[model samples]
Target: MSHYAVFGHPVSHSLSPRIHAEFGRQTGIALDYTAIEATPAGFAQALDAFAAAGGKGANVTLPLKEAAFALCSVTSERARRAGAVNTLTRNDGQWHGDNTDGIGLVRDLTARLGLDLRGRRTLLLGAGGSARGVAPALLDAGVSELVIANRTPERADALVDLLGEPGRAHSRYWNDLVNEGDFALIVNATSASRDGLQEFSLPFALAASRTLAVDLNYGEAAIPFLAWAQAAGCRDRVDGLGMLVEQAAAAFELWHGVRPDTAGVYATLRGKDASLVTAD
Candidate 1:
């Protein structure tokens, strides 16, 4: 059987195994997908073992994406731009890194949610890896302008500098967000959502006009931000579940050369309600 898994420190909580299993069943592919918990110090050893055992691909998450990028012999342009890799494919005795987070987000928004991002103004909260991973894709998808904001102003400025184009992308302090008016889309990529921090305040006007408020952290991490978005009267509030499944699908495609149907798998995984799955 072809083997695959997701690598993360706290990976036991991931629903990837269930999601991919459903995709495999639906697509008539035989595979084993599971979650592997690897601490920062142990990731290299774990990866080596998996590769030696003939693992075809792996999905990486959290604090290890950058490490995965460094470990790969080759990396996709998107991964290079983001400085991180969430997907890895083993081929010809070498590992290749790719960043599918942005593509996943775009697919969920444009394909699933039917949101039109073209020529739309967007506000991206947080300037960390999550924000950086998705910013370039959003711009490429035709977002008229993107304003990246963070609690620490310098981080946001640094991302802007890294992106290197003032015409479309800009950086601003979190406090300045209130005066920037409404945006068509608002994406919360901050760890604040995951940490259950409620100290961050957003502009009421912006919140009200945002067609979608997307929290990159799903399940428990999404609660605080979703609550805020609901209270702020946003039209649609979504978590990262869709993005997770889509990115995994992208990784599977890179390895198997087949794009598995994700809609059914996404709905099935969402219905399980366990957040994590185990082999029976």
Candidate 2:
């Protein structure tokens, strides 16, 4: 079987192995996919060992995305723009990196969540790797205005400047959310909850009755932000599960030369019934 894995510090919770197994079943491709725990300091060494062990490709998550990017021999434009790499493929004794996070999030938002990003006023919380990965895609999706907010004002400004869309993208201090006014879509891209940090106490007025709230963290980590959105009367809320599944499909395609259908796998994962998964 071809070998693959996902590398992250706290990756036991990842559904990637199961997701890719289903994809392999659908395509009749024998593959072994697993999770490998690796900290930033050990990432390069772990990756090199994986490549030596017949590993074809892998996914990088959390604090390791930027580290993965630095190790890549070459990268896609999106990866370069994000300054992070979430997907890696071994080729010609070197690694080729790509950032599938943005496209995955966009597909989940537009196709699964029925969101029309065109001309929408969107608020992106956080200016870290997660934010960087998706900001360009959000702009490409045609958000009329993208407001990035973070505790570190300089980081937020730096991300906006990197995006290179001065007229449409801007940054704000986290405490200034109230004066920034309400937004149609508010996405929590921070790792606060995932890192066990205190839940963000955002201004309620920043959301309106028609606002949609999103948290880029899944499972228990998503609850704090989703709960806040609920109390604020957000019309809809979403966790990162959809994006996770979509991004896995993208990576599967990149690795195996085909994109398995994601709907059934997503439903199965969401409903916790593996028997219901269908790759077709």
Candidate 3:
């Protein structure tokens, strides 16, 4: 069987193996997928070894996304725009990279959640790789204004510069989001949620009763942020679980030349215990 895996610093919690196995079963594509924990220092060696061992493709997560992008001999336009790579495929003696994070998020929000993003004002929390991968997609989805805020304002500004559409997307300091304006959609693209951050501390003023607050983290990692949104009276809240399945399907299509049905796979995973989950 062809081999594949997901690379990340703390990957033991990944649901990717399960997701890919379901995709293989659905599409009748035989493959082996696993999760490998790799710190920043060991990522390159592990990836090189995987490629040398005939691994066809792999999913790159967390701190390794940007590193994977750096190592790619060729990258899709989306990956170039994202400045990160969440999916890696072995091409003709080289690594080809692509980022499906933004597309996955948009599909989950618009198609699965029945939320229309067109003309919606959006607030994105965190300017890290996770935020970088999805910001362009959110802008492309017709969000009226996409504000990228981070603890370090300079990083957010740098991202806006890279995005280069000041009229549509810009940066705001984290402290200024409350005074800036209310948003129809708020996305948490930070690692803070995974760190068990209890107090999101975002201004309730920035959310209307109908505001959709989404954490780009699922399971236990998502609880505190979702609870904060709920306490702030934002009735619409979502975690990143749907995005995980959707993105996996995209990668499966890339590797297998067939798109697996994701609804059943998503439902199957959601029915399991929350403690056994991971998404990136």
> Which candidate wins on lDDT?
3
Itemize residue pairs with steric clashes in candidate 2: none
**Measured by TM-score, how close is model 1 to the native structure?**
0.90
Candidate 3 local Cα displacement, residue 122, angstroms: 0.4
Q: Which has the higher TM-score value, candidate number 1 or candidate number 3?
A: 3
Query: Which is the leading candidate under TM-score?
Result: 3
Runs in model 3 deviating more than 4 A are none
Model 1, which residues run further than 4 Å from truth? 198-200, 274-280
Q: Listing every candidate in turn, what is its Cα RMSD in Å to the true structure after a full C-alpha superposition?
A: 2.9, 3.3, 1.1
For model 2, the stretches where C-alpha displacement exceeds 4 angstroms are: 273-280
Give the per-residue lDDT digits (tens) of candidate 1, residues 97-189.
999989999999889989888988889998877787888898989999999999898988988887776999999988777799888788888
Backbone collision tally, model 1:
0
- Which has the higher lDDT value, candidate number 1 or candidate number 2? 2
> 19-79, model 2: which lDDT tens digit per residue?
9999999889999999999998999999999999999999988778888989999999999
Give the alpha-carbon lDDT of every model.
0.82, 0.87, 0.88
* TM-score head-to-head 1 vs 2, winner: 2
Clashes of each: 0, 0, 0
